[model samples]
Target: MTGGRGRFITFEGGDGAGKTTQSRLLADHFAAQGRTVVHTREPGGTDFGVEVREIVLHSRSHIDPRAEALLYAADRAHHVATVVRPALERGDVVLQDRYFDSSVAYQGAGRVLDAGQIRDLSIWAVDGLLPDLTILLDLDPSAARARLDVARTRYDRLEAEAAEFHERVRAAFLDLAAAEPERFLVVDAALPVEEIARIVRERVDASA
Candidate 1:
């Protein structure tokens, strides 16, 4: 169990925040340090997850919030049991692009579900699995959106959401980091990608 799966590091942020780029850098760094690093993403990390992702992210019309939450939770449960846990047990450093944090921000904050309720449901869904670290690449909503052009999926439905809603999600994410200072990494992602990557490199190396 200890030979391959090392630790699980998750990268989380709003769209256009450059988490995927930074996560890969960190994964490569870990690999250079002689660890087995697996770079993956949520909602589509497995075959079933891939199928579910389309239903969740690509629905043509508005889907009920409660139903969307259930879909995300279900995808997460499958991802953990099939993809995440096995990688961890193999001692691979799992670098995930998005995870539970998305549910908390999107469904809890954006969807108007009571934060406490979402937290409880998420806890039950994942059965206590938590990231070793969550790097939140903080950026202004408008700036991020401009960089992103337009959202392409039903998940992007949230993309067209009111700025106030995204603001709430941002505040909630910040609050989450505040609540758990040790595990939440707040970075100013408004900087140029390379500069942001540099800061990420410094921070991740320190953490590693």
Candidate 2:
């Protein structure tokens, strides 16, 4: 897929950090510029992935930590193979919501698992396909929660975690961005939506 001259852009952030909104805006911006864009998300990008996503995110019982990690890896493996890679191979800009970084943060930091191992699992699952650019939208967990739709009856498994868990997830995201500064663009998620979109577009234009 890397040989196809296409770009893979991923959004990484804590819950309600506006990844979905920003990813859509970026894809739309590229599309308006006449670029072929494929917008997708982890754990639900393919038919197989959707089933896995439902089990992992909405199951009523407590999932074992390792089992949860493996489930995520399985979804990522299938999603990359069936959706992400093929889209990239076709020379289209692939904008993804929540790639490996989410696993590293949610399962590793939030779930108290080894971060290195979680990263390794994700890398192996995706066959070492890293995003060309990862936009990390940094936000305070409290503020993020406020952005959630309160009218909804239940939160997803990860989103229902305590404030401390979200704090750790946020920290892990920043740590990952720090480790790979060249490949990450850390943005303040509290910015106005249009401003955030403009900054993301500028970065994508400069890099992609």
Candidate 3:
């Protein structure tokens, strides 16, 4: 997929699945190789996205499911337009923490909305800018929550959801990976951090 162009890679999983850790490690790997790496995350990659991230992830007031989905799509649209696209055009490797897959899993499945519709809206929002590779850190919902509990004293609105909701989100993530086997590298998130990073680097090396 490179062919003189930049590669876009994304990470997806339930909360506390170690996405931030893994993404930072991968970014370091690219930096060591002297590659121009854009390490960013959706819903907060751009200035506008920061506000959307606050509303969608932290707001105390209840937001409609459809509205939540739209907020994510809006963030994705602007982030891709201003940040992702330009970086790719400049031949920089883009490593994103989450993408539309999160929206499909969280809003579509967790909120009981239409997954396909959410995906379609995301595609339109980003003008079909799919990742060249997506790393999915698969982990059980309960285990993920346990990790989160130890890592943080506060939880976002999504993180504070019921265990059942997290379970649904995890299942949705696995389903998305299954449907796109070629684009996804599914790894057990229960493994040691170094082991997981090694596995991810292997796949990324092959893809690159």
Give the top-scoring candidate (lDDT). 3
lDDT of 3 by residue, 69-173 (tens): 999999999999999999999999999999999999999999999999999999999988889999999999999989988998999999999999998999999
Instruction: Give the higher-lDDT candidate: 1 or 3.
Output: 3
Displacement of the residue 14 alpha carbon in candidate 1, Å: 1.0
Q: Which of 2 and 3 is ahead in lDDT?
A: 3
Q: Clashing residue pairs, candidate 3?
A: none
Which regions of candidate 2 deviate over 4 angstroms? 1-3, 149-151
Clashing pairs in 1: 4-90, 4-91, 4-92, 5-90, 5-91, 5-92, 6-91
Q: Can you write out model 2's per-residue Cα lDDT over 1-208, one digit (the tens) per residue?
A: 3426788999999888899999999988989989998999988998998899899999999899999999999999999888888888888899999999999999999999999999999999989999999999999999999888663567998888899999999999999999999999999999999999999999988875
Candidate with best TM-score: 3
TM-score to native of every candidate shown = 0.90, 0.96, 0.98
Model 2: worst 10 consecutive residues (lDDT sum): 1-10
- Worst-scoring 10-residue span by lDDT in model 3: 1-10
Provide the global lDDT of candidate 1 against the true structure.
0.81
